[model samples]
Target: AQSVTQLDSQVPVFEEAPVELRCNYSSSVSVYLFWYVQYPNQGLQLLLKYLSGSTLVKGINGFEAEFNKSQTSFHLRKPSVHISDTAEYFCAVHEGSQGNLIFGKGTKLSVKP
Candidate 1:
C-alpha cells in the first residue's frame, strides 16, 4: 500500500515570499508521485508529477518539486508566491498495479499581502 502525508496543514506567507510544502510518502513498491492544487471553488489541477527519469520536476504557477527516493519525500517549493496562489495543495502517490492514487489531507496556502 502507498500513502501520502503532508507535514503542514496550513502555510501562511506574505506575497512575493518563498514557500515550501512538505510531503512524504510510504510505499513498499515503486510508485508515481504527483502534486495537485485546488483553488477556491475549483477542481483539483495537476501542479506537477514525477513519473520517471528526472528527480526535479517543475509545474505550473512557478512551482517545483524534488523527488528524493532515499527519504521518500517530494516537497513542493515556490521561490515567490502571489495572492492568487492561495489554495489547497494535495500530495498523491499512484500505486502502479491498480493505478490508484492515495492522497494526503492537503496543505492550505494562504498568501497575504
Candidate 2:
C-alpha cells in the first residue's frame, strides 16, 4: 500500500521569495517519487523525480528536491519564486513500477507581489 500527504493545502509566498513544499509518502516497498506542477488550465508538468543514484534531483523552473529514504520524504524547494510560479503542486509515488500510482490532494502556491 502507498499513500501521499501534502501537509499543506495552501502556501503563500512573496515574489522572489524562497519556498518549500513539504511532502511525505508511505509505502510497503521501494517506489519512485515525483513532483508535478499544474498551471491554470494546463496539464501537469514534471517538476522533478527521484529514481536512484543521486539523493538530490533538479528539475525545470529552478526547482530541486532531495530524496530521503530513511524518512521516506521528498520535499520540493525553490530558492527564488516568481509570480508566474503560482500553481498547484502534487506529489506522487509509483509503486515498484509505473502501474500503481498514488497522488496527494495538492498544494496551491499563491505568489503575491
Candidate 3:
C-alpha cells in the first residue's frame, strides 16, 4: 500500500515570496507521484507528476518538485508566489498496478499582500 503525507496543513506567505510545500510518501513497491492544486470553488488540477526518468519534475504556474527516491519525498517548490496562488494543494500516490490514488489531507496555501 502507498500513502501520502503533507507535512503542513497550512502555509501563509507574502505575495512574491518563495514557498515550499512538503510531501512525503510511504510505499513498499514502486509508485507514481503527483501533485494537484485546487483553487477556491474549483476542481483539482494536475500540478506535476513523476512516473519515471527525471527526478526533477516541473509543473504549471511556476511550480516544480524533486522526486527523492531514498527519502521517499517529493516536495513542491516555487520561487515566488502570488495572491492568486492561494488554494489547497494535495499530494497523491499510485501503486501496485492500481489506478486508484491515495491522497494526503492537503495543505492550504494562503498568499497575502
Candidate 4:
C-alpha cells in the first residue's frame, strides 16, 4: 500500500513571499505522483505530477516540485505567491494496480495580503 504524509498541517505566509509545502510518500511499487489544490468547498484541481520525466515538474499558479526518489519526497514550492494562493493543497499517490489515489490529509496554505 502507498501512503502520503504532509508534514505541515498549515502554512501561513505573507503575500508575494516564497513558500514550501513538504510531502513524503511510502510505496512498495512505482507510483504516479500528483499535487492538487482546493478552494474552500470546490473540487480539487491538478497542480502538477511526476509521471515520468525529469525530477523537476512545474504546475499552475507558479508552483513547482522536484521528485526525489531516494527521499521519497515531492515537495511543492513557489518563488512568489499571491493572496489568492491561499487554499488547501494535497499530495497524492496513485497505485497502478488498484487504479486508486491515496491523498494526504491536506496542508492549508494561508497567504496574507
Please provide TM-scores, in order, for all candidate models, with all chains considered together.
0.96, 0.94, 0.96, 0.96
Q: What is the lDDT of residue 67 in candidate 4?
A: 93
Candidate 2 has a TM-score of: 0.94
TM-score of structure candidate 4 = 0.96
What are the per-residue Cα lDDT tens digits for candidate 1 across 43-72?
999999998999999999899999999999
| Candidate 1 overall lDDT versus native | 0.95
lDDT of 4 at 72: 94
Model 4 spans > 4 angstroms off: none
Model 2: residues >4 Å from true position, as ranges? Answer: 96-98
Candidate 3: the clashing residue pairs are none
What is every candidate's alpha-carbon RMSD to the true fold? 0.9, 1.2, 0.9, 1.0
> What tens digits encode model 2's per-residue C-alpha lDDT throughout 6-62?
999999999999999999999767779999999999999889888899999999999
Deviating ranges (above 4 Å) for candidate 1: none
Per residue, candidate 4 scores C-alpha lDDT tens digits across 1-113 of 77999999999999999999999999866768999999998999999999987999999989999999999999999999898999999999997666788999999999998
Q: Compare candidates 3 and 4 on lDDT and give the better one.
A: 3
